[model samples]
Target: MTRTTSALVVESAGAEPQLALVTLDSLRVNGVLVEMYVTGVCHTDLGCMEGYLPVQFPNVFGHEGAGVVLETGNGVTDL
Candidate 1:
């Protein structure tokens, strides 16, 4: 199955974050999909956006977040 979702994307170094639509692949076994309700961008993200970090372009950041599990795939035994 195919799915689409919105994401904050940085097209390249020094590029501002933008809301973009992204596709999703079928969930793998034990995979989970989360809908983030709370997220924060720390200095690390800012550094990347400012081209101070060595990370590649066209990145998806914001790992500091909390979310609700919307779906769980096969082999998932606990929430």
Candidate 2:
């Protein structure tokens, strides 16, 4: 299968956030493979942007998300 690198990444310190369409690293999860199509912006993300919450530099900020399952891990039975 093909893989792509992408993230809603920040560039520099205190820079305006931009949509970064980047090639993603090969990542694996020990469960159902979730292929995300649309992810919603949460208040926490805004907090990171506005310097309210302390976040790591160049943070990939998106939690409330929805996606499709692509693969399953070992011992996975439910679908």
Candidate 3:
């Protein structure tokens, strides 16, 4: 089975262009959930997307993001 996740890509803050995609994964965490509502892009996203600041590549870069609890980890009890 394949799970699709929407993520924000940080290319550069003011230089690199960011992107969003749903990638494939093998393992999953417990506290991990999906953001079903609409997520808005902000200036901070631009900075990260454009690589204006140093950021990890091919990683979710949404800090001010909004989502719901989809799955819980092994020790996660508070939903």
Which model scores highest in lDDT?
A: 1
Which whole-number lDDT from 0 to 100 does residue 21 have in model 3? 66
Q: Residue 62 of candidate 2: its Cα lDDT?
A: 75
Q: Which candidate leads in TM-score?
A: 1
Q: Model 3 scores what on Cα lDDT?
A: 0.57
lDDT, candidate 2, equals 0.70
- Structural RMSD, model 2: 3.0
Which sections of candidate 3 miss by over 4 Å?
5-21, 24-30, 59-61
Q: Where in model 2 is the C-alpha error above 4 Å?
A: 1-3, 21-32, 75-79
Candidate 3, residues 29-61: lDDT per residue as tens digits?
544555556566677666666767666765454
lDDT of 1 at 42: 94
The CA-based lDDT of model 1 is what? 0.89
Clashing pairs in 2: 4-24, 5-22, 5-23, 5-24
lDDT of 1 by residue, 1-79 (tens): 8789999999999888899998988888889989888899999999988899889878888989999998999999997
TM-score of 2: 0.63
